[model samples]
Every structure is written in C-alpha cells, then in structure tokens.
Target chain A: MDTEEIYREMANSIVSLDQEKAVHLANQALDESMDLLQVIEKGFGEGIRKVGDLWDEGEFFLPELMSGAQIMEKAVDIITPGLQSSGSERQSSGKVLLATIEGDIHSIGKTIVATMLKANGFQVVDLGTDVKAEKIVDEAIKGDIDIIGVSTLLTTTMVNQKKVIDLLNQKNIRNKFKVIFGGAPVTQGWVDECGADGYAENAVESVKLVKELIQ
Target chain B: MLFTNWLEDKSKIILFDGAMGTQLMNRDLEPGKIPDLLNIENPEVVKKVLASYYDAGSDMVQTCTFSSNVVSLNRHNISNLYQKINVEAINNIKAILPSEENLIVGDIGPSGEFRPPVGNASGDMWKAGFQKQAKILAPGIDLWHIETISDLQEMSAAIQGIKEVSEKPIIASMTYRKTKTRGFFTIMGDSVETCVTKLEEEKVDVIGTNCTLGSDQMIELIKELVNLTDIPISAKPNAGQPRLSGGNTLYDQPVEDYVNDIGQMIDLGVKIVGGCCGTTPTHIRKIRTLIDSR
Candidate 1:
C-alpha cells in the first residue's frame, strides 16, 4: 500500500476500535521504513481526534471513547520505539498532572482525561484517585508540571479541587502552573469561583482546555 | 427480613431517603476523608443522618455503604476493611431505627471498575466484588439497593452477586444524563430502552434512574421509565446541578421547587422516590408532606 493508504488504514483501525488491526498497521508501517512520527500524527492521532469528535457529537459513549484511546495507545506503543531509536522524537505539547481530588475514590473520569491528554500529545503524570491536596501540589512542584488537572466525580469531594489551588496559593506559587477542574459536578462557574484557570465538561474537552491553557 | 412482599400496598408510595454524601458533608466530613470509614470511626454521624431522614418521614433509608465495595475500597487501600465497613454501616442504621416497620436498604454504588474493551475488569471481577459486600450486608439489611450505576453489564453483575447471597428485593438504579437528542442515556451510552430491558431481564423489583439530572429533568426521564416498566420506578435525582459557592459545592434547587418537581414524578406513576446528591432532610420532609397530603 502507498504511504497515504497505510495512514488511512491506521486511522480507520482506531475509528473502528480495532486494536489488532491498528497494531498490525503500525508494524507494517515500520517495516516499510515509514516515518514513525508521521505514522502517529497523521494516522493514529488523526483517528483519536475523530473519536473525540464522535464523543462530542454524542455518537460515541464512554466505552467507545476509552476503547478508542486504548487502541491509539497500543498503536503508539508499536511506533514510539522506532522514533526514539531513530532519534526523531515528537515534541510534547506540555506536561500535566492529573488526579481525582482527595475523598473521592471515583477514577473513571480522571482516567479518561489522562488517556485523552496522552493521546493528544501531553505528557501526563496520573496521581490516581483519593489524592490529597498536599501530595498533588508537592508532585506539581517536583515534576515542574505546566498544568494540574484535578477531578472529583462526587459533589462533596469537589471542594478538594479548590483545595489544591488553595495549597498552591498558600505556597505562593499559584502562578507557576495552570489549574483546570473536571468531573461531573465541575462547571465553568465553579472553576471561576474556586479560582481555577479552566474547566472541561468531559474527556474530549479536557484536551482542548489543557492545550489552550499551556499556550 | 427480605420483605419480598414489600410492595404489596400498591396505593401507598414508598419513600426512600435523601443523599448520604450530602448529609455527611453537612456534619463536617473533611474534604479527603473516606465516607465509608465513618461507619466504623463515627457511627453517630451515620446514625444521625439516617435518623433525620427517618424523622423526616422516610419509610426506607439506605445504609452508608455506597462506597465500601471491594473495588472502590481497594483504591483507598482499605479493601481488607470491606466486610467490616459494610457490617458497621448496616449496624449504624439498625441502631437508630425507630422500629422494624421501617426498611433499611443495603446501599450499593458502582464498583468504579469497568469491564473489557474499555477497562481491564471483567464481569466476574465485578460479580465477586459485589458478592463479597452483599454477603456482609445481607444479614442485617432488609433489602438491597444498587444505585448510580452507569453500565448495564456492571448492573447485571451486581444483581447476580446480591442474588447469590440472599433473596432480598433489589432496586436497580442507573444514573443518566439528559441528551440533546430527545432522550436520557447513561454515561456508558445505555439508552432508556436498553436500561429498561436489562433491568427487566434481571427481574429486579424496582427499576429507576438516579443522580446527574435534577428533579425537573428527572420528571421526563421518570415519565419514560413509567411508560416502559410495570415494575416499581424510583426517581432520586440530584437536588439539582451542583454549583460552587464560597469554595463549597451546593445544590441550589430549593426544597419547595424540588418537591414540586417530585410531585410531577408521582403524578406520572413513579412509586419509589427520593433525592440523590445534594438532597437533605428538608427536601425529604417536604416530600413526606406531599406524599401524606396526596
């Protein structure tokens, strides 16, 4: 197949959530001496972007969205080493620290955001769920992260997202990183009320919000 | 005390209690502390929340074991305390009940773990997690209530797990978001028809929707549910969409307004009703007045 044909098949593989096909295409592209970064950006990345659009349009749901992300991740795994061994690494958009704020054990929303952010070229450090504000802020400082994404699916735990921002300001380093809020209960108004930099309603929007914040 | 015949009085509407997480916060639960731990560490608080609901005329109040299931507890490194948490959660409610006439729902929330294609967890994993909790909670509680679940697969596993342990009446509720496409759907993309079909196939005593949508939004969804299922329907919508005020999350839907919306739900033939996130005893009190006056 031609280079463009291979890329189309790769994109289709993710759009269909066909992981085996995506992996096969990734390997085929490498064997044909294709540019690995192009395989990712034009092929798998294009597919994930389409999946995100379908998610936004309500044509896709959480399972489809997460499955698409997982497929993209697997395809990228097959392609990344080729780029690295060839010393042609793709530039990351920015680094983000993601967590489900403390007191909330819900992690699906946060995990979807992490997967989408990673698929969209952001380096993500997931702190997992029930993370304390101190630990979140401490990691933000330690990692020199560009953005902190705090999420809580429970209404009661929503306060801890604000707590993370408060801890940052208490340390007098609020300006050092952009803080974005997410989860079912978070709103744009809540983000503003809590002094957060931004809020995204879902995983698809999280990528766009994180990108705009870093910019 | 499986009250398998609990719904025999078709004329009387069964009232479930309001939100546990909301009451816990009002009682000064810290931002990061696990709510389930309160069962073992602070039984009084859990009892107080249930007592207020009972006083407000809730015929049935759920135990504070929503997040004590193995999968969720494991995330907090308290998986070993799962059985203990479930036991104490039921004990706390039993201690405060005014009489045996009032029902105690053994509340179960989602496992927070997803199955295949989307997540690594399997149906068996979900079944095991729920079964473990059900075994501990079934002995004390009168019935089982599984709520706020998004995936039908998980719901099926929950039903199987609970049924494996006891013959309690199961109230299966899934949380849904109102879509712009003229219907309500769970976040997992299960449509109302799909939800109704699954719950019916599982032979649950109650089929309903809860969380995400407010009472106003729930009116339409409950209307749809009433049309689809002959089984008793439950509507436990959020007080409304939560809004942040002064750095604390609050549900701005007023008690009168919330009860009014619930009234519409009752008119549409909803049998089991209560609040979800952000509801308190005040909302339940008004609902009690509405039910009695009706």
Candidate 2:
C-alpha cells in the first residue's frame, strides 16, 4: 500500500480497536521510511481526533475512546524517536501538571484530558490519582509547569483541588502557574470559587482551555 | 424470606442510605486512604455511619465495601485485606441493623479497571474481583447492590459474578450524565433505553441511575426508566449539584428540596429511593418523612 493508504488503514485500525493491526501499520510506516511526523499527524492523530469526535457525538463511548488512546500512545511511542532523530521540527506547547486531587481515585477524566492535551502538543506530567496538594505543588515547582490541572470525581474530594491552589499560594508561587480544575462534580462556579484559572467540562474543551491559557 | 419478597410485601417505597464515603470522611476518615479499611480497623466509625442511616429511617444500608473488590483494593496496596474488608464491612452494618428486617446490602462498585479493548482488565478479571467480594459478603448481607457503574460491560460482568455466588436479588445501578443534547446517558454513553433493556436482560431485580446526577435530574431519568421497565426502579441521586465554597464541595439542595424531588420520584412510580453523593442523614430523614406521609 502507498503511504496514504497505509495512513488511512492505521487510522481505521485505531477506530476499530485493532491493536495488532495498528502496531503492524505503525511498523510498516517505519519500515517504509514514511515521514514520521506525517504518520503521527495523519494516522495516529487523525484516528484519535475521530474517536474524540465520535465521543462528542455520543456515537462512541469511554471504552472506544480509551482504546483508541491506547493505540495512539503505542503508535506514537514507536514513531516519536524516529521523528526526533530525523530532525523534524518538534512542536513544544506549554507544560501541564495534571492530577486527580487527594481523596479521589477517579482517573478516567483526568487521563482523557492528558491524552487530549498530548495530542494537542502539550507536555503533560500526570501525577496520577489521589495526589496530595503538597505533591502537586512540589511537582509544579520542580517541573516548571505552566499549568496545574486538578480533577475530582467526588464532592468530598473537591476541596483538595482548592487545597492545591492554597498550597501554591502559601508557597508564594500561585502566580507562577495557572491552575485548572475539572471532573464530574466540578463546575464553572466551582472553578471560580476554588480560585482556579480555568475549567473544562470535557477533554476537548480542556485542550482548548489550555491553549488559550498559554497563549 | 428473601429480601426481595419482603420488599414486595411492604407497600411503601424502600429507602436506601446515602453517601457513606462522605459521612465517613466527615467522621475523620483520612483522605486518600481506603474507606473500607475502617471496616476492619475501626468498626466503630463504620458502625456510626450505618447507625446514622438506620436512625434516619433507611430500610436498607450498604456496607462500606463499595471499593472492596480486589482490583480497587489492590490500588490501595491492601488487596490482601480484600476478603476481610468486605466481610467486615458487612458484619459492621449487620451489627448496627435494628432488626433482621433492616437490610444490609453488599455494596459493590466499579472495579476501577476498564475492560478491554479499552483497558487492560479482562471480563474474567472483573467477574472474579466481584465474585470474590460477593462470596465473602453474601453470607452476611441480604442482597447485592452494584452501583456507581458507568460501563455496561462492567455492570453485566458484576451481575454475572453476583449470580454465580448467590441467588440473592441484585440492585444494579449505573451513574449517568445529562448529555449536552439533553439526553440521559451513562458516562460510557449507554442510554436510559439501553440500560433498561440490558439490566432487564441481566435479570437485575431493580435497575436505576445513581451518583452522578442530583435528584432533580434523577426524577427526569426515572421518568424515562419507568416507561421502559416493569421491574422496580431505584433513584439515588446526589443531594444536589456540587458547588465549591470556601474550599469545600457543598451540595446545596435543602433537605426539603431533596425530599420534594423524591416525592416526585414516588409520584412517577419509583419504588426504591435514596441518596448518593452529598446526601446525609438529614436528607434521608426528610425522605423518610415524605415516604411515611405517603
């Protein structure tokens, strides 16, 4: 198959959740000396964006979206180093530190945001779920992150999102990094109340919000 | 007699307890630690929460085993205490029940592992984790309450697991989101119609939505469900939409407002009603009063 057909097939494999086919196509692209950036943008990136669109339209569900993300992650892992070594221009967006605040174990929403942000060129440092405010602040300081995104799925844990901001303020570094809050229980009102810089209801909007913040 | 039989004999709606994790947190259960651990290490704290529900006129109280499955427990590095966590949670709730008539539900929640082609967890893993907890808690509990589930596949796997261990009736509930399109659907995109059809197929004794939406949204969802299923429908909405205030997530619905919504749920023929996140004994007491008046 030509490069275009191979890219199309790779995109189809991700949407179909065909992990093997996605991997095979990714490898085929690599072996055929396809432009690594073209493969990423046209194949894996296009595939995940389609999945996101389906999710937005309610035609695809969490499982399908997650599987597509997994496939994209795998293909990207295979292509990223090759692209870098080939001297392709690396698009560096702002760095983001993400976590599900302490007391909450809900990671799916935060994970989706991380995937979407990565797809949109943001460098995300995910601290995983049940992350403490102190740890989030410490990571932000250490990583020189531009944004700290905290999520909570439980009402009981929503306070922790604020606590992270509080800790940042206590350290006198709150102004240095923008903070975004999200999850099922979080609202725009909560984002303002928690002193977060922004809020996104879903992953797609999250990427947009991050872009706007950085810009 | 079975709990389902007893439920049928009662003419009134059954009231389940609300918000165990939040109640426990209020009682000083530390953040980020497993709440189920309290069942084994601090039965008094667990008992206190259950006792409050019982005092609030809850006909049934769920054990603090919502996250006791091996998959969830393993995340907390306490998978070794999985059996003890579930069994003790049931035992603590059973201890606090005023009588045998008061039910102790074996609470099973999401496994925290997504089943493949999305995540690494297999169907067998989900089933085994649920079955392990069910097997341990089934003896002490009156029935199984699988709740806060978002995925249909996981919900089906849980039902199959519970059925494998016991003939007890299962109350299966999924947490749904009100889509931008104004349609009721689970986080995984399972519509109310889809959930009702599938839950009925799985032979769940009761089916409904829980956790995500508040009682107002739940009333609308229950209306949709009432049209589809002949089985008992439960509605365990949050106290209200959560709003952050002074760094705390507060559910703003007044007790009266919550009970009023429950009244609407009852008017629409919802047989089982209770609270999910942000609900307290106050909410349950109000609901009890509403149900009693009816």
Candidate 3:
C-alpha cells in the first residue's frame, strides 16, 4: 500500500479495534518510510477523534468508546518509541500533569484528555486517580510542568480541585503552572470557584485549552 | 436474632425500612453532599427522623451512612476526617435507639465509581475505606447493610472487608434502573439472575433490592427475581418517580399510593418490603398497617 493508504488502514483498524491489524498497518506505514508525525496524525489521532465524535453524537456508547481508546493506546504504544528513538525534530508543545483528584475514583475522563493531548504532541504526565494534592504540586515543581489537569466526577469531590489549587498558592507554587479542571459536575462556574486557569467541556476541547493556556 | 430468621418463623408480613434519602433531604441535606454527615454534625435532626421512622412502624432502620465511604467523603473536603466521620455516623445512629433488637443496619454504600486496579480505586484503597468505616460502625451495628451496591466488583470488595473483621450478618442489596420502565437489570447491566447467582457466592445473610424505581417497578423486578433464586428477598422501592417541580424533587405518588402497591411486591415473594426515596414514617405506618392486616 501507499503511505496514505497504509495510514488509512491503520486508522480503520484502530476504529474497528482490531489491535493486530492496527499494529500491522502502523508498522507497515512506518516501514513505508512515512513521516512519523504524519503517520500518527493520519492514523491514531483521527481514529480516536472519530470515536469521540460518534460518542458525542450517541452513535457510540461507553463500551465502544473504551474499545476505541484502548485500540488507539495500543497503536500509540508501538509507534511512540519509534518516533522518540528516531530523534526527529518535531512539534514544540507544552508540558502538563493530569489526575483524578484524591477521593474520586473516576479516571476515564482524565485518561481521555491525557490521550488526546499526548496525541497532539503535548507532554502529559498522567498521575492517575485518588491523587493527593501535595503529590500533584510536587510533580509540577519537580517536572517543571506547565499545566495541571484535575478530574472529578462527583459534585462533592470536585472540591479537591480547589484544595489542590489552594495548597499550590499556600506553598508559593501558584504562578508556576496553569490549572485546568473537568469531569461530570465540574462546571464553568466551578472553574472560577476553584480558581483554575481553564476548563474543557470534553476531551477534544481539552487539547485546545492546554495549547491556549501554554501560549 | 436474625431478621430473616425472625421473618421466616413469623406468620405476619415484614415491616421494611422507610424513605431514607427523602427523609434525610427534608432534614436539610444539600444536593450531592454526604447526607450521613448530618448524623455527626446535627445528631438531633437525624435522631428525630429515625425515631419518626421507627414510630411510623419501620421495624428496620438504616443508619445515615450511604455516602459515608471515604471516597465520597473526600469529595466534600472531609478526606482527613474519615475516622471521625464514620465514628460520628455510628455513634449518632446508636444515640437514636436504646437497644440491639431494634437493628441499626450499618449502611455500607458505594463509591459511585467502577471497581479498582482497572479503575482508579485500588482494591487496597477500597478495603482500607471499608475497614476504617466498619471498625467504627461494626461495634454499634446489629447488622451491616451493604446497601445500594450496583456492581459486583464493589460488592466483592465490601464483602471481603466485612468478613475480615466483623461477623455481623451483611445484607447485600443493589439499585436497578429500569431500562424499559421496569426492566430486570441493574444500572451496570447485571440482571437479577446474575445478581442472585453472584450474591449467593458472597455469602450474604440477606440478599435484596432497594433505592431504584417506585413500588410498581420494584414489584416487577422482584417478580422477575423470584424465578432466579430462592434467597430471602427484600424490596425497598422509591415512593414513585422523581419529578422536578418548583425547583425541588417531588414524588407525585403520596404515602397511601405507595402503600397501596406493597401487596404486589409481597405477592412477588418480597420477604421484606419498605419505601426508598419518597418514603417517610407516615408511609411506613401505612405499610405497617397494610402488612399487619394482611
């Protein structure tokens, strides 16, 4: 297959959740001497974006979204090391830390945001869920992270986003990194209440928000 | 004495629990806030409500600890206060009644998320949360009511925790959302047959249903459930569907309307019948009156 054809096959495989086919097509696309970024942009990114669109439009539900995301993750796993090992001059993006706040166990939303950001060339360090506020700030300080993304599904737990922000300010780390928040009960009002720099309604918007925050 | 044992030998039908959340909301619970916090911060209000439920003929009263899990508490900025929160939750429930016979079911509720390792809540975290809450609650509780559990993953975690410490009979129940306006499936898509088979392995003393659709819906689900297992079934349904009126949640079906439907749940082999969302002492009294006469 041609480069574009190979990339399209990889995208279809990921969307279809045929991990082996996705792996094969991605490897073929890479072997065809396609640009690494071009392969990722055409294949995994578009596949995940299509899955997200289907989810938003109710054509796909949670299980399908999960399967599609998992496929994209599998594809990325193989492609990432090749791209990194090649030492090619690539896009310059921002650094970000994302986590589901401590006491909240819902991490899927945060995972989606991190995946999309990473696919778009942002440096996203996923802290995982039930994360302590100190650990978040500590990571930011240690890694010199540019953005902190906190996710919480419960209305009561969303307060942790504010708590993390409060500790950052208390520890004299507020101005170090921009904070963005999202999840089920996280509103635009909550963004102001938590004193976060930005908020995204969904994963697709999170990339735009992170880019804007860094710029 | 086991409520189920007492229930099995007795000729009279059971007087199940009452509308815990609705009664709790009436006592000034904010939306999405842990209602069990009232048990600690304002014991008198919780006392009045429970006493009212008992007086209203509710033989069984669940403690105000549905959202008392550490995961849910941290949501409300009570992360460092897990022990205090649960201790107060138990003590407040103890303060409401004088004796062990009046069974205060320690409510071991869900974390509102998928189970861990694959999800965010690690099995260790879930166990730790349950252990901390149960350590304080087990001493005061006559029975540990693992109520409103939706998924098998969480139920397994909670059961594993309870068996580690307390020997109290744990009553496991789940909430089912009606897919077709009275479907026999849980919110997570587990059917009543699946629930019965899985719950049997967990070794819960009393297995049942609670906190979903109204009496009619509960009856439909229960009837479907009867074909699945011979396990002692408990049914505590909502008074009716929730409706938004004047910016407040209201169940259009009154106490009598709910009590009127109790017979159907009973006919479906519901061993224990009570109210859930819209129930109060008044509804329980009517239920008691209805059950006693039958």
Q: What is the TM-score of each candidate against the true structure?
A: 0.93, 0.88, 0.67
Q: Write the candidate numbers in order of decreasing TM-score.
A: 1, 2, 3
- Which portions of model 1 show Cα errors greater than 4 Å? A85-87, A132-135, A170-172, B1-6
Task: For candidate 3, report its TM-score.
Answer: 0.67
Runs of candidate 2 exceeding 4 Å displacement:
A1-47, A74-82, A102-105, B6-10
The C-alpha lDDT values of all candidates are 0.88, 0.84, 0.74
1 or 2, greater by lDDT: 1
Error of 1 at A192 (Å): 1.2
lDDT of 2: 0.84
Q: Residue-wise lDDT of candidate 1 within B9-115, one digit each (tens)?
A: 77778889999887898788876577889999999988999999999999999999988889878877889999789888888998999887799899999887887
Q: Which candidate leads the pack in TM-score? A: 1
Query: What docking grade applies to model 3?
Result: incorrect
Q: Candidate 3: give the TM-score of chain A.
A: 0.83
Write model 3 residue lDDT over B1-294, tens digit each, in one string. 756566576564667678666676665566445667776677788777878877777767878887777765665567677777677767776777745557788888887555421246666677777777788788877787787777766777888888888988877888876543335565445767788888899888768888767887777787787888777778888777654333244667867778777887777677777777777788888888888787
lDDT of 2 at B136: 90
Show pairs that collide, candidate 3: A156-B75, A157-B75
Q: Write the per-residue lDDT of candidate 2 for residues B1-294, one digit (tens) a residue.
A: 657675586576888898988788677666567788998889999899899999999999988998999888877778899977877787788788898778888899999887554457878889998888889988887888899998888899999988998998889999988776648887677888988889999989888678878888888888888899888888899888777676455677888888899999989988888999889999999889888887
Name the lDDT value of residue B141 in candidate 3.
76
Q: How would you class the docking of model 1?
A: medium
